[model samples]
Target chain A: MKKFFLGFALVSLLIAGVLSYFASGDPDGLDKTVEDTGIAAHAQEHPFAGSTFADYALGGDSKFTGLAGALGVIVVLAVSFSLFWFLRKRPDAR
Target chain B: MHMSDGLLNAPVSVAFLVIAAVGVGFALVKARADLDDRTAPMAGLVATFIFAVQMINFPILPGASGHLLGGALAAILVGPYVGALCVTIVLVVQALLFADGGLTALGANVTNMALIGTATGFVVAVALRRLAERGKGGLAAVAFVSAFVNTVVAATGFVVEYAIGGAGGVEIGKVALLMWGLHALIGIGEGLITAATVTSVAAIRPDLVYLLRGSRKPLEVRS
Candidate 1:
């Protein structure tokens, strides 16, 4: 089970690292809707727009962006595992 | 669909934030009851995997693309309670770390993608699973259908939110119609990926798929 999970996690990391670079750069459904409806004018910049790694990349370099994407996956894994670890029922407790 | 700030007024934003917080909190408590050591990592993996998948957007129409929402897929893999919690964490991480969704609009996003999406998808999958015969392609087919429906419902969620709190000048009905139409296309992509993923996992790790648990049976000996 651990081996399978590790492989699964590795595959996910690869997709995020490599395949994400090939993802369409076009605006997504909501963004396109805002543009089509002329509501794009009302969309405000995120308060953290200037933060490091904003938009999932640092300087628009493809390699850096890919690395950042991989890092994002790891960060999510770590955080979620931490949360679930606490929330999981311990069999020995009862 | 990650809505930025200013799309909704402060009151509407606050209202959704409160609602989403309560919903997620309830999910956490509920999930804790069912989550054991073995299942805990599964839930975490679902969240992590979906976060990575969400980055890859496929073009649905001219100049418009969509990404995996992962609500239905997660619900089908794990149960709905943990599924919702997983996606909520993904949304929170996206908002705070990547800024994919607006910080102010986090509540609305969570409500749409986490609460409503997973709930509807799980219910739909279970209903379809019941209607179909066991141990065939039925489970995978229902997974696709559930995922497709999940996206449409989530899209409608945005429409409802916009109606209640839209700051733009566009007609509410028109936006709703367009949102629905565009998401229908996006839902196709969502459905296909979900079907493929669920089927793949069911093939290798059938025990991991909560929706398929009932359908699995011991191999029969020929007379």
Candidate 2:
């Protein structure tokens, strides 16, 4: 059962990573509205813009970027699960 | 919507972080009361489902594509606190790992999509459920309205941020109206999916649905 859950999470994360890359880079509804109304340019640059993972890509080829993206999701999920699992008190372990 | 870093003014961004922190603090307390072994797994599963559903983008008009925000859906299926936590976790993961949203913008994204969206949606759901007397159909309606409200609220947040840190002179009113109108349409899609998902969960494990508390009518009255 645990393996099944883990497998499901892995597959979902991979799909999410790939689809995220394909998501419309064009301003979304909010962005479009902002642009049309002339406030779109008001956005400031993030202080952390120089970070390696600043954008979706990590300064690599598209395929390589996609793989990195997928791995990132897996790592995040694993870390989150571990934190929650550890914090969780066992019925008697507590 | 994932607002990337440098998207909003520092003050506005910092303000949102404060709001998000309060909401998260509240959620932590609430979750402790509501979460059990079963609820924890259910929340995790719901998060995964949200991740999947968000991938299927539907065209907004001719070219623009928008996907499920999942705040309302998560809040309704699980308790509000847990729902907020689930969506926030997803956003955090997306930002740090996938770089889907900007790292610096993580706080703003969580505030808009997770805190404001979930709180507004949950409130709407509660109101709608009360009006409908907990009828099965009521759950669907609540989900729809909640999702719609959340999207609108998120859009409004963006407008406010722009007003504070606009690049140059621009009309805020027009921008607000335009964003609000387009998001209303996007909200419809969010609403439908949330309603559908909530209805499905209510059908199978009605008990799992947090928004359907005392309102759930007896399936069959004792003779």
TM-scores of all candidate predictions against the true structure: 0.95, 0.80
Off by over 4 Å in 1: A60-63, B131-133, B216-223
Which run of 10 residues does model 1 chain B get worst, by summed lDDT?
A: B214-223
Residue-wise C-alpha lDDT for candidate 1, range B123-195, written one tens digit per residue: 9988887632354367667888899999999989888888898787689888887888888998899899888
Highest lDDT scorer: 1
How displaced is residue A45 in candidate 2, in Å? 6.1
Cα lDDT computed for each candidate against the true fold: 0.84, 0.69
Interface RMSD of 1: 0.9
Which residue pairs show backbone clashes in model 2?
A42-B167, A44-B6, A45-B6, A46-B6
Which one wins on TM-score?
Answer: 1
Residue B184 displacement in candidate 1 (angstroms): 0.4
lDDT of 2 by residue, B80-140 (tens): 8888887887787666645566665676778878888888888887777674345557767
lDDT score for candidate 1 against the true structure: 0.84
